[model samples]
Target: MTNTKRKWFIYSLVGIGIILISLLAYCIYLYQVINDSRTSEMDTTKTQLLEQTSYVDIHSIESFHGTNSYHVLEAMNEAGEDKLVFYPLEGEQRQLTVFDMEDMLSKNTLIETWQSSCGSCKLVNVTPALVEGEAYWEITYHDNENNYVMNYHSITDGSLQEQFKYPKMFY
Candidate 1:
């Protein structure tokens, strides 16, 4: 090939190589950005759920016998009677079924000597010592005798601390 023709060929190959490299780099950067965004979204969701958990009402069933037979479980809404078995404290809400309660209560500490209302109640093995100054504590219990178990943890350092699970017999 003549000098000019050879030069033209070489330049064409170099241009194609540069274009290919640019496209590859862009694709890699896009993948990283999407991955990072997804991770951040999940973290935000978790934080919101933790915050909602702090405000749901957790009370003793012993105190509720005369008030209302239909006790609304916390983290759950009044519609559909769905129990808040698990969810981000604020974003998504899920119900706890009868089987779910039974599973959770199976490991709970049964309050054998209680006389107020929950005669055969099962509570999580959580004590004041486990919660006093801590920021969170996971508690699980049977929502009712029907075998619905509700599991939840509390956020202790904020305005929502009053909703922390105290020993209760709502079952």
Candidate 2:
């Protein structure tokens, strides 16, 4: 081929390579910006949730059975009168419970009922939550071998409304 033609071909290849590299860098920068925005949005959502609920108090409860250890938390719900929220720290199944704070504190009927229902499981935390305009209790419990269980018990009758078990692995 002629020298001029060869030189033009090389120049074109170099230009294309530079353009490709620039595009890749731009894509990477865009991805990072998007990821950061998403993180910020999540933080804002969490803050909004806390503000909407107006939790008066937060409590952490820890329990152990044999070799298993359980971590639970309770938060008072100011948005709803006589309500508490409960949840567990880490597990395949995370549970949230909202129940009548007054009944839980005074009568302790929910705890008693839970004991009766699952003798092997121990209550970890109780929190009040508003679910679809209805008040509910989120209860976290730990059974044998560090197994985490979550139960939503009705405040009216202390009946188990929903339940979940933590998965062993995330993926």
In order of listing, the candidates' clash counts read 6, 18
* 1-171: candidate 1 lDDT, tens digit per residue: 599999999999999999999999999999999988865654554445446544332221111111111111233233333222322122233422111222232212323322133445465443211123232223334444545343333322212233333444463
TM-score of 1: 0.35
Output the TM-score of candidate 2: 0.38
Residue 31 error for model 2, in Å?
Answer: 32
CA lDDT, every model vs. true structure: 0.38, 0.59
After superposition, which runs of candidate 2 have C-alpha atoms over 4 Å from their true positions? Answer: 1-107
